[model samples]
Target chain A: MNDFVYKWRNPIFGSVSVVLFFLGWEALLTWAIPLNPFIMSKPSLIFEGLWLEMQSGQLWSDLLISGQPFIFGFGAAIVVGIFVGTMMGWRARVGYALDPLLTALYASPLVAIAPLVIIFFGVGVSGKAILIFVLCVFPFVFNTYAGVKSVDRLLVNVVRSLGGNERDIYLKVIVPSVLPFIIAGARYAIGRALVGILVGEFFAATAGIGYRIAWFSDMFELSRMFGYILVMMVVAVLFTEGIRWAERAAFPWRVGM
Target chain B: MNDTTSTAVSPVPASAAPVRDEGLGEITRRTFWEANERHALGIGFIVFVLLLWEVIPHILTLSRGMDLFFTTPTQVAMTLYNMFASGEIWPAFKFSAVAFSVGLGLSIVAALPLGVIIGRSHTMNAMLDPFITAFNATPRLVFLPIILVWFGIGMWSVVVVVFIGAVFPLLINTYAGVRNADRLLINVVRSFGASEWQINKLVILPNSMPFIIAGLRLAIGRAILGIVVAEFFGGSSEGIGVMMNDAAGKFQVDIVFAGLVIFMALSLVMVGGVKVLEARLSRWRPENVKSF
Candidate 1:
């Protein structure tokens, strides 16, 4: 119980501090800012907006609609990124040939050409998914490439000398070595993918968190917009923490340093 | 043995001075050509892309309107020249330039020292890791609304976004650099009765230079990306991002492409500039070259 207390102190303090920070924000809004209650929202007002949205069921419906394309696009990015990364990583000739091309594509301003994407795929699920895919794929591909490159070259030689099969080498050496990097890449990818989806919604969306934001902005409902932003932020934090926890659990070797 | 073979392919013409004493002119030419021959494939790929870009629109679409969507290099180039003539490009470029400079300068100043301080204390790194992770997890762009609230919708807002985007890489790299400094070297320096300042200046700074530069490379790329996103999202008055947004809203696909092309070129130049600086710094520490 004492040990638990010691461990929990930081988290508890962190939570309290966050609460205090928001309370301070509430206080500031109450005391400061010249605007009336309607134009600029207080924290209490935003929470009320959030409550109203929850009661009206708009939040859930928007979440479902937004989540569908996000999942599809993110899934596609992972599969394609892993496949392309593995291909480039394993074959020297392929790596030499494709590196520059991939680098250029990866470096391009995907958001700028988002309109062209919308034109090609229509301002629908496909367009947003494509945007998400383009934005999400680069870190996965690049990090996986780096991961594979950084694998123990000596281990590969040893496996070959020991007459290990291709499957054996991949299962034993390459996969394990690159796992951490892939996790890191995925962590990065999720954030980018989220941003892409949000931006896509902002530009050309019928529904989603982005749509809600735009809706609120158009209506001058600052409280509702702030609430939506906060909700999305909470979701993001949870997702990030979940992945980080899983990473730490899976890579226990990295712990107790 | 590997060093000699690799040095043979080193492209710095300045290295030719070392070869001059050995009268290896023809060999230098052969090596340079061999290296260039390898890179020729990359150049060829670029040419193929340019050709494809030019040819695909013509072959795939019959309508002139469709050409606007799938723009050719010529169309983009013409659009760029048109924008240049109209004097619309400079304001956007200047805005981005100023924003990037201020943001990157602030990031370097703030993050590097903070990283060093954090690196010096394992307890601090451990304690702050989660908080840092939480910050990193939230897309730096999300700070746009909050920054807009704090600083209003202008150049300062854009700079703040860019600074937020750039700082993580800088801080991470700096901390990593300092923490990974050779313990033996530190001990040796300490044994020599050097002051902490002397040790940090002579040992820590030099050792961390490469990592800081690596961070700077990432920072520049990220900074440009942030500037674009910030301008697009925040009420940025002028920038390539704003130009792209306006062009897209107006359905001027070619101008959008022009704005994006300029942004890409600037990003490439920034990365390349950082790389050259990194190379120059790496030259000073021959013994420190191989590991990192």
Candidate 2:
């Protein structure tokens, strides 16, 4: 019983702190603001708004809209990133050749250029997806390329000495060595991709979580906007945790995991 | 990413001539070129992009009498030049730079101590794990409206947004640095009867400098991101974002592009400046680890 209590003490305390924070927030909203309750609704009111939005299917639709671009962009990042990164890793000359452009693209703030993308692609899913792609792909590719380059030279030389062909050298020597970097990169990319989606929705789109939050903000529906922000936070947390889970599953050999 | 191979290689050039049957001078030069050549693609891409930007609008105008969708590089340059000449860009730049500095400063102050404290305590780490996860993962832009409600749509609200956004990276990095400090070294310091403050100052600070600096780099980028988002939502009267908002409203594609170019350039310069500083620090740092 003592051990159980000790183990759970911090979690309990943390939870209580969080609960108290919300309670305090509610108290401030109510008593501190003697006049306009609707302007800054209480925590209870925010919860009720969340429940209302959920019941109306508005929250679900908003989630789906926000989620679509994230899914598309993330998928594109993994596929294209892996392909290009692997190629760049295996082919030194090619990697060297493309290095400068990738660096510029990697350094460029794609969010700032989000408007240009909207101009070219229109204010739709395409623009959002492109923004996400440009933002997320760089880290993935860079990590993968680094992983490939950092592969044990001794192992490669051994394979070569054993008369291993390029295909054998790549499959047996390079891919496994670089897998961890790829996974790590992908893990980082997930958060970036989400940011991209949010940024896109903020600027260009008429739908998605970003759009909903902005819409609520514009209307000055403080409580509902707060509710949507919470929802977005939940989504981001879940997405990040899912990525970490995937990384642990795929790269069990990773020391920390 | 260029290693200090030259300094290490120069002395060996004369001595290694007969040892490897090839002069070390040749190897060093090859390494230098190989390092430098990595930048070729970036140069080529810039040229290619410039060419496209220059050619595309002219072709569109000639073929369809429409350059609405496609703006020329010349037009973008002209817009930037006009903004520069008129000194219209200064206020926005000043606002952003000031906001960025303040938020970044606040984040460093709050995060560094908190992170160090968390790093020092396992109980605190386990306790705040989920909370920190949620806090860090939360898209701060979503809070812009609420923050505006609380702080009002001014520098304070924008600064709050930037603070929230930038704090996570510094905290994470500081925690990482402290956690990763060599156990043996800590023990050695402790054996000398060092106080907590002494250990932190002499041992922990030096060991974690790289990670702390790395976190600062990430924080700066996040700071820029948060500033832009805050400006977009929180009704900021000036800054690049206001220009962006104005340009977007009027469908001034060239002006919008110009704003974007300025922003990207600013970000690149800031990030690149930090990268250079990091490189210099790493070189001067006692540890001889290779950097990427």
Candidate 3:
């Protein structure tokens, strides 16, 4: 019994804790303090709402709509950010000129400008993509720049002594060194991009998970709103875990770092 | 070989030294320029961009239609000055400042003790880890709608949003710090007949100072974002975000820009303040150990 308990401790404890939490929530709502259903939803109600939405295929459509901006924005950010970051890292002049501007943008609440962005690009996929791009791009740029700055000087010298040219050094040394940083930046960008998507959709969007959430909340469909939030939570966890898994696969040695 | 390598790696061009026979005054000037080159270039670049921003609308005749969406830097500056000079910004600033401080303070109070407890106890950590992970992964904005419903749309809702945004980072970092505290030191304290409370007070809290400060730095940005976003969505009419939203609705682009500048400045000051605190508090730590 002790051996079995030890073997299954994590799973056993984890499940018990989750189950207990849900049960307690349900019990509190049902018996202890019966609040208005619309104000505070129970786990059962949320699940039921989720199931209904899933069956109606609204959830899938919302997911698809939201995924487009995220994919396009994140994809563009990676390409542009890496390119810009490489330029900045390679040339001290470029880095010096751009650092302050980038720092200001990174630190500021860029979401406040969502309305202006919508005005520029219209309330469409492009606008959302652009917003997400702006939100996600900075992390990549900063990380890649730092990674390049921290590249082993000795390695570069060794490459040069071996008659390697700039292109060879970049392709063989710089790219590999910076790949981990790029991955790490992508991890940061995932959360930022999600926030961007939500803010964009909240501000002005016809279709998307965020729009649905706003719609549900406006309509006082609290359970449905909770359902959508659950979906967002799941997506966030999946995306973050996926990136972490990729990072581990790519650079096993840099796990803790 | 050393000379060649040094010259090759040096940022200063060798030709600059040789092309002009420099006097003491010239050498001093050049050295000063070199020392502050990054700052000079950065400021110069900003000035160049601002000039372009001021000129482009006029040059392209975009001031007629596009000016509603995009304003020149001078216009933004003027609007910012007017907001302050006329005392229009003070109420909004006060509203946001109160919410931010209260929310962040509450988070610090709640998270610090809970984080220490969770970090110290295996059973508590095991039980609570999954819930913390889920909540942390979930964007705090998703809770805004429910919070608004529960708390009713006002300063309290905004405070709740800021609290949620700011709490997880601090909690997680504090937990990490406590876990990463020198086990050897704890054992040493134990051997000296120190209790767990004494050990935690003496060794663990001090060891975790850098991590906690880093967490606070991250939390400040999130908390600021929370303030803006919560005010934007919560229908609070008395914060910077509400002012910006109102301006946006009116197509007062300059006012929106001014508000954004204020937020940026606020973030910079808070983060900078925390960094100074971190530096002062962690003076005893080795350089390598203080990186976090």
Candidate 4:
């Protein structure tokens, strides 16, 4: 009992604090601002709203709509970004040539360019996917470039000294070396991809969680809006945790995880 | 990132310098700066890409002379020049600056103390960590719709959006900074019968400066993002975002490009400032270990 308590004390206390926080908010909403759910929503009403949306079948479809851009844009970004990043990593000139453009794209608030994105790509899933791709590709490229560029020359020399060819050098050394960097880049990209969806759907997306957020809020359906917010947060948390798990599984040698 | 790399590469053993033929990390930066200031291969590559973008239309012989979504660099430059000459961008720039300042100010005020309290208290840290991580992972733009509903359409909503977006980085960094306090130092201070406030002031706050500075750097980017996105969605009429919207609505791709350039420049300036401060504050920080 003592060992168990010691081991899980933080979690227990933390759960208590979180529960207290919710109870406090519930009390404030129930007694203080009962008249105006729009001002600040209560937990009960939010769950109720969530239930209504789920029952109406609009929730699942919107979730799928939101998932599509993530699948398309983030998927494409992962595949192509790793390739470009690897190429840039292998070739010094390629890294130099692309570095300036990548720097600009990375630093610039791509959110400001949403209007231009919509204009150029015509407010479709493809357009939104493009936005997600553009927003997400930078981090992968940077981490990958950094990872590949910074590889030790001594290792390559040692491999060459041994009867290893270029293919052997790449397969034996570079791939395993840059795996962590690729994962780091993807981890960074995931958050941006989520934001890219919101930015895309906010502008003119036809059907997505972000679209519902905009539509519901415009109609003063704060509970429904907050419901979607909660759902998206769950999705985001799950995605982040999932990546973390994969990173740990892939690189058991790393310490920071 | 470039500046960081140059300094970061210095801590390596000298033995590896001659084994390899060329180190791009060393040579690229040195030559990029030393040769004609403009004739470096890096600069040449950058210029070639931009010039290629400018000439692609002519090369392709596209119909309507590249008016259909492809913009030339020279055209973007000319349009930016005209906007500057006409003094139209200044007001939008001012609005964004005001919102950014006000919002960042609010976030700093809110996040610092709360973070300290949570950091020092084990219970608070345990409970708040999950919430903080969840909110941080969730994009700040998701809050824009709710902020708009609560505050209505105006600068106020934009400011709140900025505040929400920027606060978490500061809070999380401050928490980490405080929580990672040196145990030996804390015990030594306690043995001297130091008050909690004295210990915090003498040790915790001072030790946390690097993390706080790093957090500030992260927050600046998020705040800028929030302000721009908020203005776009919050129906504000006075921001650079509004100007981009107007330009984009009319298919003025050059103006949109101009706005983008300005925003990127602003972000670079902030990042540069933070990098300078970080260098100054991080003297005790050992050179980062290279991960392989």
Candidate 5:
């Protein structure tokens, strides 16, 4: 019995806690307080609303709309950020020259520039994509730069002393060392990318999950709004977990690094 | 984020020395330039960009249209000056300041104790881990709609947003710090007949200082973003974000730029302050480990 308890501890406790929380929340709304559904929604009601929305295909369409810019922007960020970060990292002068500007950009709330982005790119997919790009790029840039900087001097020297040329050094030493940092940066970028898509859609987009969220809120469809929020939460969890799984698969030895 | 902090402050490495022989005066000049090279290059690059930003639009005849959407640094500066001179920015600034302080204060108060509890307790950690992970993973903005519904479109709603944005990072980091506290020191305290409370106060808290400070650094950025995005979404007509939003709608691009500049400055000052505190607090350690 003790062995079984220990083996199943995490799942058992996690589920019980989650179930009890939802039950308590439902009971509090239903009996203890009896608040209006329009003001505060219950979990069952949220699930029901979500089911209806899913059946109507609205949720799928919204996901598709939101996913486009997220993919484009995130993909572009990975390419450009890695290139720029590599250049900055490999060349000391390049890093010095660009350090101040990059730091300022990284430190600031990039979302505040959403309006300006919309103005230049227009209220379209391109604008939202650009916003996500700006939001997601810095983590990649900085992390990759740090990774490059952190490469072992001894390893590089070993490569050079063994008749290895620049390409050989890069392939054998630098790329392998920096791959983990790039993955770590991607993990960070996922959250920022979500924020970018939301803010972009909020600012000007005509379609997308963010637009649906705003529309539901404005119309006071509280249950549906909660439903969409749950979808967002699930999406966030899935994306994060997926990346973690990839990281583990790619670098099994560096599990906690 | 933690990685960037160390890299940002580390001194830049000087380039390889020129091998060719030269005059003594020329060599001295070259050495001086090399010593100050990073700062000079950084400042010079910024100035060049600003000049280009000021000139390119006019040269391309895009300035006329640009004024409607993009503004020059000079225009942005003038707008900032006029806003302050006319006392126009104070009310918005005051509102945001109050919300920021209150929300961040509440986050610290709530997270620190709860984090310590969860970190120290196996049962509590097991039960709460899933919930914490879920909330932390979800963008805090997703809560804004429900928050606005519950708190209405005002300071409280904005405060709640900021609190949510700032709290998770602090809580998670604090928990990590406590869990990763020096177990050897705790054992030493136990051997000395210290009670649980004494152990925590004497060893755990002090050891976790760096982690808590790193958490605060992360929280400040999230909190600032929360302030602007919350105000933007909430339609509160009395914060910097609201002011910027209003300016955008009216095509007052300069005002928007000015507001963004202020936000950037606030972020830099607050983050820089926290970095200084972190450095001071961790001075005793031989090497500061990056924690997030």
Candidate 6:
């Protein structure tokens, strides 16, 4: 429990745990245990396969392929979600009117019905973007709606009492307070959009990480499949970590937000 | 108000005992479903939307051939009725249900203890934070290919996907709930010679109940998503997802819509039912700033 020891203890322990996990993964595949490597390929093999894929230039193209759909879909979700959410929050009637529809969609497995989307948008970038849009938009809208609704009424009252106009109240008080929630919403939206791209690619697509993953999995190339998954996870982690860092940088005064 | 202020410490005070609105739970659930009870306008709005779904397609079909892409509500209802009559929907529904329940059960079992450990000790949190965060952020769909390879194309793989989908929200919420347990309460219990286990049992667990329930609500949504996705891509070829996919492939838009209705019903039942249950469980718990 010493303060000095505690500072380094966790990081060291984390590193040790990760190393132990990889070691186990490596050791599990045999030369010793007879559990098919084709099924559960070792970490070294996976990385090596990934390295080979990298050199073949497949990884870069897949990244670019998935990246465009991700950006457009996620960007649209942010723009439209915040607008609709804020509007719903600002007007009680709008919220009530939309509640039944939104709630149904929220509860249902809309993602599973990707084929229906294909019928509408066709199997193009537009279709993929629409898929991502549907998947990612809800979190942002809900968060922004909650953010707006939960804004301190007392603060608004104080602003109005001080002769603040509607524009001033919105810009200075509402927007500032709601910004953190928007960013938080965007964070979740990123993951949802990622799934949209992957799922979209999985069903119908030409070039993407998900397409490669499916292709490898089908061919029984477990190592390459694992490699792609590893890369996918790394990209996801970096995106999430980036968002979290941005949250801190943006809201320096707000702790544990 | 003036009289109450003057009688601040009255002997044998009539207001000594707290009163609860027992009907409040049912009333609030009704409010959520009906929005406001002023004139049953929310119910009207819902009905209107359903009617529109039926009417619009009919209008379009009357003018041109539009039913191929999207079907009317009557067709969907009839398809649903026929599917049930033929006993086709049951097997798939049962399969998906098993996956959902098993996955959710496993997630709760695994996450509760882990969440408590990481939450109770800052050291554990700091050590495991990176791994947990990274896993949570990564789409659970990514694990599908791995699970399929490891578990093979079966219910086990589907269950694994559900577990991955649901576990994080549960774990993170439980952790937050534990961390945010009142320090003053902990100190008070400690002063009274309460052990760590006692504190956790009597104080921490109850304090965290609402958070856990909220997490469960979120986890159900994720689990539903997981089950459907797992069925589609993880290779089991038999669940509601499979049935929907088959319908979609066959251009049975009505059947697909029927399946969508079923999914909606299941979702509503799970989430709405759980929200009511959470409300009931935490009825006696004191209110604080909701971390959710």
Individual DockQ of the candidates? 0.23, 0.40, 0.51, 0.53, 0.51, 0.34
Give the winner by lDDT: 1 or 6: 6
Model 4, residue B9: distance off in Å is 9.4
Q: What is the lDDT of residue A173 in candidate 1?
A: 80
- Per-residue lDDT tens digits for candidate 3, residues A126-207, read 9999999999999999998888776766677789899999898888877888899999998889889989989988888888
Candidate 4 backbone clash number: 0
Q: Poorest 10 consecutive residues of model 2 chain A by lDDT?
A: A33-42
Residue-wise lDDT of candidate 5 within B1-292, one digit each (tens)?
A: 1133223334333542453455455667777777788899888888889999999777876656765676789999999999999998999999999999999999999999999999999889989988998888888888887898888889999999999999999999899899999889999999999999998899989878888998999999999999999988863668999999888888998998899899899999999999888878877777636433
Task: Return the candidate ranking by TM-score, descending.
Answer: 3, 5, 4, 6, 2, 1
* Candidate 3 runs further than 4 Å off: A1-12, A159-168, B1-30
Tens digit of per-residue lDDT, candidate 1, span A1-257: 99996777667656666677678778987777555644567788899989999999999999898898899899999999988887666664456667787787666667777766777788888999998999999888887777776677667667879998888888988788888888888887888888887778877888898878766766667889888887787778888777778889998775421
Highest DockQ model number = 4
How would the docking of model 5 be graded?
A: medium
How far is A186's C-alpha from truth in model 5 (Å)? 0.8
Candidate 3 C-alpha error for residue B6, in Å: 10
* Ten contiguous residues with the weakest lDDT in model 4 chain A: A88-97
As a whole number from 0 to 100, the lDDT of residue B8 in candidate 4 is 21
Give the per-residue lDDT digits (tens) of candidate 4, residues A159-181. 88998998987887777777888
| TM-score comparison, 5 vs 6, better candidate | 5
Give a tens-digit lDDT track for model 6, residues A100-167.
67767867878876888876688888999999999889888888877777676666667889998888
| Shift in Å, residue A50, candidate 5 | 1.1
Q: Interface RMSD (C-alpha) of each candidate? A: 6.0, 5.5, 4.0, 4.5, 4.9, 8.1
Candidate 5, residues A8-109, lDDT tens digits: the string is: 898889889999999999999888997786788899899999999999998999999999999999999999999889877877777888889888989999
Q: What is the lDDT of residue B217 in candidate 5?
A: 90
What residue runs in model 2 are displaced by over 4 Å at the alpha carbon?
A1-20, A23-39, A156-172, A204-206, A255-257, B1-18, B21-25, B28-36, B58-66, B183-194, B279-284, B289-292
| CA error at residue B2 for candidate 5, angstroms | 28
lDDT score of residue B66 within candidate 2: 39
